[model samples]
Target: MRRIPVRSLAVLATVGTLVLTGCGTETGDPADSTPAVAGADRTIRAHEVMQLTKVHEETGMTLLEGPTFDGTGKLLVVDVTAPAGKPKVIRVDVRKRTSQAVHTDARGAYTSAQFSPYDGRLYLTDYAHGEVVSLAPDGSDPRTFFSGDVDGARMNPDDIAFDEEGNLYVSDSRGLSTGDAHGRVVRIERDGKESTVLAEGLASTNGVSFDADYEGLWISELTQNRISYLRLDGKGGVASKHTAVRVDGGIAQTDSIAVDAAGNIYQALHGRAAMVVYDRHGERLATIEVPARAKGLESATNVAITPGGTRAYMTVSGPAGGFLYTFDALAKGVRQSNGG
Candidate 1:
């Protein structure tokens, strides 16, 4: 595997911070007025309207991913510590702006967590173990819900989402490099059986989300810097697939995605230090930069919207540490079928 030089990583991290802070140029608030994107209708300067604050900090919890919320409005996040250290799942009280570790298991690298509406339990992707696990909402009673290979290939689950019928859709991002499109989307039926829905043309599928109307599924390609949407057949299969949006210029590496009731897409643009908002037609709406306090962070990895869609929470990871940041969202989020 190729390694990123330490010096280059530092430079990238610094650039990311500067981009979010709007430090170098006097371009006069790109977020304030409408962005010059061809079809953009409105631009929301989120940093101005939404307050960014650090809610919690921990010394060893440095690789945080996934920020999901439950029906009651409690935010759940996962720390991706592995091998040498056990990963932890934490629950946060957004109202109180406080957090508590709910579960700490040494089994495998847990990267993402999703609440199952049908069972009212939290489902997590165990990347190292190549399977999915379930736990009580508070992170108790960890059990192997789905494991082993899917379609004869080792499962490297990265992120997860569910359809209206309670079936699970998982993004199996097999490797980190972009030379090969090894990523695949797997569907786990309500009965726990697994099948491959999409097995090609994806490089590092990082995030998966269903449209509010349950008509389309969005998958983020980390290394490819693109978002693909699949029209569902309403029978647990893809009717068609196509690219919804792509990040050009210097910005690449799209991460987890969140959608609102109005079908607007909120995608974390890792390395760019901003969250790019898109309308239902896949047109760029706005870019909400990360605050300057994330000075040494290389990227914002994941984003979660509140039930009411009034707020958004994102996780940033880099040399400085893992931090959770939030801001006001443009519209109310479509309440997840399964709590969050």
Candidate 2:
């Protein structure tokens, strides 16, 4: 339902329309609106799994973003707001509730991370440098992997995903802040030699995750607070796409996203300290929020379901600092939820 003119109706030429496939869902007013994720599928009270930032930030606050599982079941997260002296990438021990540094570039602000199943290397998106860098599983051999461009314009990449065949898809999040259609979903070929703009013309593309079958993509556009399903053409490009879900509320923007084995989408909200679980059809399943006692935690920036199960961990941050919260997921975890 339209809470208040959430987005502009203008469409962009660079974007692929779902009208061709007749599967596109559009935003509507509350009077004629599609059912919003009313309250939630189930109100799940998440407990404190671990804390990364400080309880009270008398100085600077840490903004924790990406939360994903590496190959060996380590909970990896990124401090997008870390200063020079702090670790940008941190790996957590799920069993013991401990943390350790992975890697961080002095000049780069990495936002999201994923392990490439194809090559078994950890790939991270440096939002500040417009580059995708890779490191070994143990956080060694850090190097610039993909700084490719789209239509000759430098990409302000946000999040990333890898297809079954190893094609890298990125969310180019430079949107309204620059101009219309600047936001794009670019595909960097598996070989890393060529890149293509799979989709474009949006607000701010944030989350990037592939469907269970690898034939479609689930993307969240932040400025508009909506999520769309991008059906692939099977050759590393989007065939058609449609607006599948929209998060309507006060100043709430969608951040990172994860998909479980059954294809449920776990999307985080930056302004609100809660995560929404939506089915493949864009129906809301649950809303996982920190209990009222957990004060100072402002937002749930990103979430990752524990590999092989429904245990979900969210990377939260605010004036209280960065922290990790746990929840019982709606379905089993899969490749999409574990990776980036």
Candidate 3:
């Protein structure tokens, strides 16, 4: 391993400063703002605040996203190569802190990935190939799980998740593309079946997760600076959505989301250098800050959790490539509700 250049470090250092200062657009009046733990109903109260403890190297040429724990608690993450290389998914042994590439394909620029609880295998979304790939647990033998032709649409997939019954849900964001540029959320069943759209005309649907109870889908609209909830009829296939949290005029560009068993929502505030959390009803709970300056927290792009939600994992963008961060999920008090 070689040292990262000082110039790049300077950029990241600046982002860390901005993160501590004030990130996100400020909106609304004092009435809607409350200390997540203060005014939160007992139902939504966060019992613990976990702090991120660095688990592995955050410096490298690999851009990591879509992190999740396998049944054994090992962390599996997708590595999107820089402009010059192919995409690969790697598995990191949390206990050992060692990582190895499991699979790579040049035809697609993989964005986000997830491990299917349905079969304990890995599923990935590729913007370049316009489809999702299912990789064996060993990271070999990739297969197409679903594609746009069946859904009547095509866009870059930013993230993905599955329901209790093994139905696949995905967020399709039209990244930097022309013509409306709205994003979509789609559902595909385990047997390779497609359903009607969950929601459409979105502004940058990046990170997504199902509610802890598995009844609704929680989605993050990055450019819109807010999170939404969709009540799903996973059985009947009807999708009704609603706004969960509205962050007024805050900064946009959210990259990933994680949910604890308590129904608290966590977001990797990309371009903000902050990991934000919210109550189930959409109240801003806490904003956990990290050190990343240039490109705002190095675009703290993805987040994952250890089994039982005891720990959380995140990756940050680097001027040269990227770095990874791990933290205790429920540690200390959540960041001052209003930056006090």
Candidate 4:
């Protein structure tokens, strides 16, 4: 198998930075401040007031992505250090402010790992291997849960999510360097059968999440710098689709996303160095800024809201190093079906 060259991957990595910093007018003037909440009488400057605490910091790790809470309240994150070193999943104890490796042997970079409510198992995306793997909640009993092809093409699963019925949805980002429109969102049935739900003109599908009401599936397209919501038919197929939110300028590369009980959407804006919050109607609510000069914490790649939604955990990756950060959230996160 021919690997996408590291240099090409680097080019893809820089897309967010260039879009966020180089695109003028798209971001507007930094001084032109406006209230985040629609129709609110007073402006709440969350970007300037929210305090961010460094939870865990590590050197030598290049890319950090995916973040989910375990049943025990520990946070699990993937270090996507491909070609340079073996990727591993690190488990963090939020209260203790400590972290440890709970799972290794990625075979390829691990993009996302989600716990299932029905079976009490961890489902992870093996990006380079084109498969989804499962593990015991404690990171044991690793096995391939789904692999091979989807819609007649290989899978490069980047993110995973589960519905109330226990079915799994995965975002397959075929490749980053190429401009081919091969991105797809696939569903793994309760019985393990796979089907493609959305596969049309997507440029590197990166994230997947369901709304609080379970009425729509939200996805982030990295290269396109937009997030969309897909209304699904009763039979696990897309009924209709529409753009929910888009990064107009200043680093439009949106990565992973999470939702709160109040229907607020938390998005990782890679190039802007911030996590953005949006109402269910796709209106901008707040911007949680991640410091740009923080040695190893440059880009915000993924976000996970804890069970109560009172706090949010984010992963930052860049040349300096990889680290996990946490901060108080304005809204409570919706509890996952599995109690994660």
Clashing residue pair totals per candidate (backbone < 3 A): 2, 3, 25, 5
Least well predicted 10-residue stretch by lDDT in candidate 1: 17-26
Compared with the true structure, what per-residue lDDT tens digits does model 2 show for residues 1-340?
A: 1112221111121122100000011111212212234335667777676777663231245677778788688888887756555687899997788999887655666778888878988888876557888889888999888785668887877788888777789988765343455688888876677889888887788888998888799999877789998998876667899999988736667887889888889888877788888888777888777766666766787888877787778787766668887767777788798756
After the best TM-score superposition of candidate 3, give how far the Cα of residue 15 lies from its true spot, in angstroms: 34
Model 2, CA-based lDDT: 0.73
What's the lDDT of the predicted structure labeled candidate 3?
Answer: 0.57
- The sequence of per-residue lDDT tens digits that candidate 1 reaches over residues 196-307 is 6554657878778888888878888877778899898876678899998886626456777778777778777666556777877878876766555436656666777777
Error of 4 at 58 (Å): 15
lDDT (Cα, tens digit) per residue for candidate 4, span 1-340:
2234221112222211110111000111223344355433223222221112222232223566777888788888776654323337778886666777777761445777788878988887777667788889888899888888877787777788788887888887765557566778888885676566565668778778888888778888877778888898877788898888886636346777777777777777665456777777877767766443354444677777778746666676555456666555656766431121
Lowest summed lDDT across 10 adjacent residues in model 3 is found at 331-340
State model 4's lDDT: 0.64
TM-score of each: 0.81, 0.85, 0.74, 0.80
Please state the error at residue 306 of candidate 2 in Å.
1.7
> How do the residues 213-290 of candidate 3 rate in per-residue lDDT, one tens digit apiece?
778878877667778888877574546877787764255355667777677777766554557777777766666544
Candidate with the greatest lDDT versus the true structure: 2
* Candidate with maximal TM-score: 2
Which candidate model has the greater lDDT, 2 or 3? 2
Cα lDDT of all candidates, in order? 0.64, 0.73, 0.57, 0.64
- How close to the true structure is residue 163 of candidate 4, measured as C-alpha lDDT? 86
Deviation in angstroms for 333 in model 2? 0.8
